[model samples]
Structure formats: C-alpha cells, structure tokens
Target: MCPPNCLHAVCEKATRRGLLKSGFTLGIAAMAGAGSLAGGARPASAATDTGPLSFSKITDMSHTLYEGFPTFSGERWFEMERPVTWEKDRVNLNRWTLMEHTGTHIDAPLHFSEDGNSVDLIPVADLLCPLAIIDIRAKAAADADAYLTPDDIAAWEAQHGEIPEGACVAMNSGWAAHLKTEKYTGLDAEGKNHTPGFHHEAARFLIEERSVRGIAVDTLSLDRGLASGEFPVHYDWLGSGRWGVECIASMDEIAPSGAYVFVGAPKVAGGSGGPSRIVALH
Candidate 1:
C-alpha cells in the first residue's frame, strides 16, 4: 500500500495509459507539501514557478533476489524455505535467509567507514534524490574492466549539464543484460571478477565537486572487479560519509538526467547495508 501523501500514491492511482493520454503533470509543490514524501526538491531544470512537472514513465530499477543470484563471493547468498503450505497448514508461509548486501542493495556508509551512518541511521532525505546516469556501455562491452572515469563525468556533463546537487549518480555499463549468466560475474581462472565500476577519481569528483548524495552501479562492486582487494572507490566514497547502491537493474531505462530515484533501503539497526527496492520516475 502506498503511504499517505506519498509519491507512490500518485503513481498507484494513475494508470500508465491514463497518464500518457492525459499528459498528466505532477505538482512539485504538492509533493513537497506532503512533508516526508519523496523528492523533497525539484530538479534544476524545473523552475519553481513552473507549477507542475510531468513524468511520463516510472521504472523499477531493482533486481529480484533468489538462491542463485550472483554475489561477490561466488557463493549463493539467498535461500527460501517453505515452512507452511496452504494445502497442509491452511496458509502459505516461507522463511527467507539472505545476506545484507544481496541482490539490488544499498551500501550504507557504515559498510566501509568505522564511524559512518548505518542503514537505519541514514537520513530520509538522502534516500530520494535526482538521478544522473553515466553511460559507458560501449567501453564496457569492449573492455569488461572498464570503469567510469573522470572523463566520463565531464562528457556526461557536457551533454546534459552539470550533475545536480544531492543527485544519485549511476553508472550504466549495460551489465544487467548479463545477469543469470556466468558473464555477469566474469570470473577468470584466477577467480578474479572482471566487471565495470567507478574509478576512485570519479567517485571523489562526485563527492568533492558535485556534492552528490550517493553513487550507484549496474555491477557487483563499486570498484572495477580487477581492483582485486583494493576497493579504492568504496573506501573513498563510503568512508567519506556517503552511501551507494549496487547491482542495480534497468539503469538503461532511466534517462541520464531529469529522473528522480527513490532508494527504499532497509532500516536495519546498525546494519552495514541491505537489499533495496529502487525506483525511478521521469
């Protein structure tokens, strides 16, 4: 069920066909008036006096978790046990066992920083923010070890203007297409995974220059898989008191800019990280 006065409520009530046909525009002021509703501020492209902003589409950017889903450790991280069945117990119930960082998940600052915010300690406002997607699909396709570099950030800004303040910058390497295949993990004979991620410099640039709320990626880890044990990007980004999302699905569906992302991170006390239901509206 949608929360009272929440943006999900508006999405739930409006049919996609109806929204398209009527060219419905959601009022930013209305959303802001809802107190704790998502998208506390409007995008820079949208003027304060513009009255309303129209979002033509909504996309779910999270991947489903199952027993066999890929994990950084090359071991299964999710399992389900049916404890009760309707035919036998008159009700269906199941027990789930999973790791905190399984599937589409958020990496709270505490994941790396000793004195950082835990999953439950993260502020509500930071969970919802503007989305900036950096496309390195071509590069990643040719070189699995490719990472989002500072040049990529500059190129994206050259085309789409500067990344908005407090935005969630995501790297779209088109890696989600490899899910369910060994290619997704890209493990070699040495057991090192070859995947796309963010370069430390790019992560630092976003934090020091753009003041972004977080970073996200379509790959398993924030640093290039070849980085081995040195997680430079993770230490620099999360240790700096910022959050991140990993294994994000459908990043290709969202625009490079002008989209808002809602990261529904689990509020597990003292948790380093947890699975999240991430959605985008544009």
Candidate 2:
C-alpha cells in the first residue's frame, strides 16, 4: 500500500521542522534539509487556493547529492574538503565538476535530438507546462518487461480523463523507488536494465493524438532499457519535434492528472542537454 504522507505519488523518506527566513534559495534549503515538504505530497484541495496568495510552497521534487546517494555512473562525487565555507567573516567558494545530468534533472532535445534544440535553445516559457501523469507501477511491479501502451493510457482516461494537447505527459512508473536497490532498477543478470517504458503506440499517441509537449519519466531513459536493436521509439518521438524528460523524481504526489509542469535547467552556453530541476503546479 502507498504511504499516507506521500503527496504527488512520491514517498517521503524524512522530514524536519523550522522557521525559514525569506529569500532562502532552494539549494540552500535542500542542503540544510529543513522545512521543505516531504516527498510524495498530495496536491492542495480544490477548495484551497493554490496560487501564490495561497500556499507558501509545496514539496520540492528534486533530490540532492553528496555522499551515500545514487550516483549516475561516475557523474557525481564529493571531494575531501567542503567546497564552500563562511570562514571567519569571509567566505571562500570553489568550483567543482558537475555532470549535465545529476541529482533531479531533465533532458533536452540535444539529449537525443541530433538536430534539435539544445538546453539553451529551448524557450523558458516552454519549460513550464501542464502535466499528465499516468501511473503504471502495479503493472511494472508485476512485470519488469512491462510497457506503456495506448490501451493502458486509454484505460486510465476511461477513469481519469483525456490527455491534453501540448501538455507534459509524465509517466510515474515508480522506478525511482528502485534506485536504491538492484531490484528497483530491475537490472538483469547480464547487467542489462529491465524497466517499464512507453511503447511506440503510446509515444505516437502522445506525439500525434495528444500533441504532447513531451514525455517525462522517473527512470534513466524514456526508452525501454532492453531495446532489441531497433530504436524506433527515439527516432519517432524526437524526430516528430517532441522531446523527452529523464532522471526525474517525486512525480507520484501530483493529483488532478493534468497540471502545469515546469523545469529550471541550466542554460549552459553552447551546451548540449545539461541538468534541470523540474516542478509541477496544479
């Protein structure tokens, strides 16, 4: 069963209590592990005002990195000493290497789009969008080789509602939970990853039928980890001017099925995909 504290389908691992000063950066709050909403938070009630005037802020879905966390291959690590210190009335800050996709992040067209938009090329407005999350955790748990099909999505719509056009259609397959354990990622005996992904039909349905802005997932890649040589899914999705969002976390808590989704990715000068922070507001 899902945990009660979970909002947006994410499970809260821990929580802290404190009064936050105004103008604290999210990075700072995240580093301090204070006052932020726990993971898997529910959306505000319909009667409640969710606008700026209403809630101060909900849970931040992004994950942080230091030690004792899931590192993407060799992309993330810490040095012997701290990188920043407010030492005796003076602060010394240092620069360290950060991979394009570390912690909680989104991928750009350049991630898979050969001749498509780079991290900097995508419009800021385009970063924020309406969302549609289709949960397939149960099916995925039953079969690691499971895939998202139009039929499955159609079944969801039979209950939830239709997938809107130009919206960010996110699939919360509950894969992030598997990040800590080998069983979560469902990696095979041969080191091959076995995870849930969208079928070509589902991708086509979103790209053509739903006219989606893009597709996002809580996994490493949008395509099924064990593709049998053919990558029609990638070729079709990116080739059709649509993009993909990967390595995302904390999507399950979102309710209303359709809400505005946003991304704050670094616009590296002449960069490729780079890293991004994703947000969702109903």
Candidate 3:
C-alpha cells in the first residue's frame, strides 16, 4: 500500500522528516561499504609516492539479479541452476540465462535507433562522467505518470548549478524503495502501467540543450509506463548517440550533483542492450 497522504501513487511533497519517519532512509548504510571501483589503481599523485590519493566512499547503485526478479511483462526473467556442487563435482558452478535488458542494464543506441552504435561500440570514456540527479519522486508520488519537464530541470539547476555538458543525469523517483511492491511496475485498475519517466520535452532539453551524455532512472523504462508503444526518451537519447541506464538502484544515497559514476557492462557483439554493474563515488 502507498504511504499516508499518498494515493495509489506517491505524494508530491517529501520532507526530510517524512523520509526518515517513514523508514525510507533505513538500511541504506549497507549500500555504502565499498570504495573506488578503480580498485588498486591510484591517481598519479599517489603514484609519485608523495602521499596516498584521497579516497571517497563508494555506493553500489546496481541491483542484484537473481532468478525470478520482476521483469517487464512478456520479457524473459533471469533463471539459474546449479550445474555442479562441491559434493558432486568438487566445485560450485552455476549457469544463468537472461535477456540483455534484464535487471540493472544499459540501453545502447542500437536498442532503438537502427543507425546507432551497438553495445561494443560505445566508447569507454563515455560510460563514466559527472553525475547529476533530478529528484521528481515527490511529484511522481502524486501522479504515477508524471515526468520531468524543462522547469524541473531548471529547478534542479538553480540549486545545484548548471548540469555540465557530457555529464550523466539520473532521474531519481524514489521508486526503488517500492521495488518489493506492485507499485514498482504500477498497474492500475484498467491494466495500464503508470510510472514516472522523462517527458519528451525534458528529454529533448537534456540531450539537445544540455548536451548530456546519458540518463538513468529508477524505473523500468526511460519513457513513462503509459507511453504505450512510443519510447520517446530512448529515441531522443540513443538516437543522438547518447546512452542510457535503467533500473538503477539506491540513487537516493547520492547527492543531487558532484558525484562520479562508472557504468561497467559486458561488451556483447552486435548487442542492443546488456546487463550493467553501475556504481557511484561521492
């Protein structure tokens, strides 16, 4: 069920008190135990033996994929079975199969545009960039179909300064907290799925005006759930040679801006989309 003052969807106003009082902020510390996806590789300052490079906390923004996690209806869900066990084969081995876009994943340009680059073609440098988060969860809680508009982007900018060119933008709906509920997929009485996403104008503004490198969301698709068959967000971003990340988890842990994210996904030949392991450093 939705929280008090939130109807079938979430509420439009979220206060720090409300977020804490509702227990939405609990257990989040568990997501921040790791640091530095770059691993043992240190910056040049430390390489010179002057001193150790300053370290930052790492927060994993990817969801753990497992057998039978919720998937878009009609799409293949993940499945795994143990092929070998310690008692039988002297080792533990398991095999799993899933669609490319399943769970936390990236949608390469080829996923939507015929002329766009495939997963293997996306440059390594483009996958990592400045992170800017646009929080519209409060508004989305009031209307499941709500999307970010130009004004919304401006509002975020007013507080965080301009969203830099080539930066990665994240649309944090606070919906990840609802992943265990039916509200994650948001099926209404009439069987329509209503969820938050990027409005067409907002998408265009981000891509054409702001020159953003990519966008991520906490929902199933960058387009709203009720977009029916039209994927405006995908067409706008991927069509323009930009990439997108979907089903990103734990975005609420990061600040609205000034963070860096690394999008690491297997490079599948001729693939349109693939599973990704995304992380943020703050």
Candidate 4:
C-alpha cells in the first residue's frame, strides 16, 4: 500500500521534472530560432552577428519554501516529511504538503474569476517577458500599508522609459527583507496585515492603459494588506485574464528595467495556481 498523501508526492516530483524539461526545450527552441533568423545554421555556443543573447547576471526571485512560511490566513501552510530516509532506505525522498498559494507563488486568473484561465492554461509566451521593477521601498519603509499607485508608475516610466508592452511590472517594496519575521506580515493589534502591494488605480492603469502581461510583488497579495478584505487589485487584474506573482524574493538584485523574467509556473492540470520559481536575467 502507498503512504498517506502519496499522490501529492508524485505530483510534486512530476511538477519539478516538467518544469525542467519545459525550460530546456524552450531554451533550445529559442537558440534554434535565433540561428534560423541569422540565415545559417550556427553552433549553440556560437554568437550571432548581432551578438549572442546573453545575460550578465541571473537572479532568483522566488523565495524558498518551508513549513513555516507565512500564508494569507496566518496559518502554517506547508509541511514536509522524509518518507524515505537516506540512512534507512539508501535514498532520500520527501513528501510535501502545501497549499497552491504558499511561499513564492503565481496567482492564475481563475483564482478570482470563474471563467478565467488556470495556471496550466496560461500561455507559455506570457511567462517570459521584460521585467519592470517599480521601487516603492522608501514609501513602504515609512508606511507598511503603502502600495504602488499610478503616479508611482508614471514616475518610474519618466525615468526609465515607458514600460515595455507585455512586461511584468513588479513592486520592489523591500518586503522580502522581512521574510520569516513577524514584521513580514506586520499584523496590527487588530490582526490586520499591513503590507505593501498594488493600489486599485495602479492595477487598472496597468490593465487598461498598459499592455502588461502581469504584475508581481514582494508581498503576500496584490492588494495592500490594509485593504480590509477588499481585494480590488486582485479582482480587477486577474479578472482581465492576467496573472500575478506574490512573495517574490531578491528584488534588490534586479534593476528597475533592462531585465527579463522567466516565471516557472507549474503545469498542474486544473490548478488555480501554484508555487513558482521565478528568475530574472540582466
């Protein structure tokens, strides 16, 4: 007989393997496409006449998942058990029990809209796009309930050129610095989560005015924590058939612009969303 929750264990392994395979395939396809456009077959290591597409640095933007990672409900949402021990079974295997939205995760449109796309249904092309980091660290340092407003976006564009269409606009609130701490959630005396996120107007601007593929944040939700259970950003953005990433890490390493992001969202069939491995290249 199989152990309890064995299906979840299998699914976890499959998800990891699938992500790796997909990345590998995509990389090869991109290289081949570049070579084809160059008018001749070129070795994978050879640079194109216009110069090879390369990154000077790669930064991981996904936070490590652990049993104690904070969740929206203020409860422990991840657990792990070593079902196969190295000393006893000559191998190491763990069974993880986690909520789809735990840790650093993607929020599919279906998370808010019934007729929206699920994680697996999101277009592969949308997962890879330019990254635009909107720095709100100073504001958030003063007010934990600070959020990305349309004015902030305008200011960012004024300095760093207009945000590229189909880019992922991320909020660098410096919240990742408070990970695994009580300050991360900033629970008030009344049990309200005081974290930085996207303002409703900002969400509307990105969705209606800009052609962004999605939004990301270094916090727990797309809406400011003080929204008092009113997730306007979440509903507005996701309802428009776009996705969002939350709990991102290492925002400090990525520049405000001139970087591309790869969102390694899981391919879980019918899943509303799942923990994702997000990386940035610059």
Q: Model 3, 28-64: lDDT tens per residue?
A: 2222222111212111111122222122445789988
lDDT of 2 by residue, 70-154 (tens): 4434224433254677774367555656666555666666655567666676655455555778888898888887888898889
Candidate 1 at residue 258, lDDT? Answer: 88
lDDT string, candidate 1, 77-165, tens digits: 88899989989998877998988988999999899888888889877666767789999999999999998999999999999998876
Candidate 3 clashing pairs, residues 3+ apart or interchain: 10-141, 12-138
Q: Any idea how many clashes model 4 has?
A: 0
Ranking by lDDT: 1, 4, 3, 2
Which structure is stronger by lDDT: 1 or 2?
A: 1
Each model's lDDT: 0.81, 0.60, 0.74, 0.80
Angstrom error at residue 190, model 2:
1.1
Task: Provide the lDDT at 274 for model 1.
Answer: 92
Give TM-scores for every candidate, taking all chains together and pairing residue i with residue i.
0.86, 0.71, 0.79, 0.82
By lDDT, the best candidate is: 1
Candidate 1 Cα outliers beyond 4 Å, as residue runs: 1-13, 20-53
Where does candidate 4 have its weakest 10-residue lDDT segment? Answer: 35-44
- The positional error of residue 252 in candidate 4, measured at the CA in angstroms, is 1.0
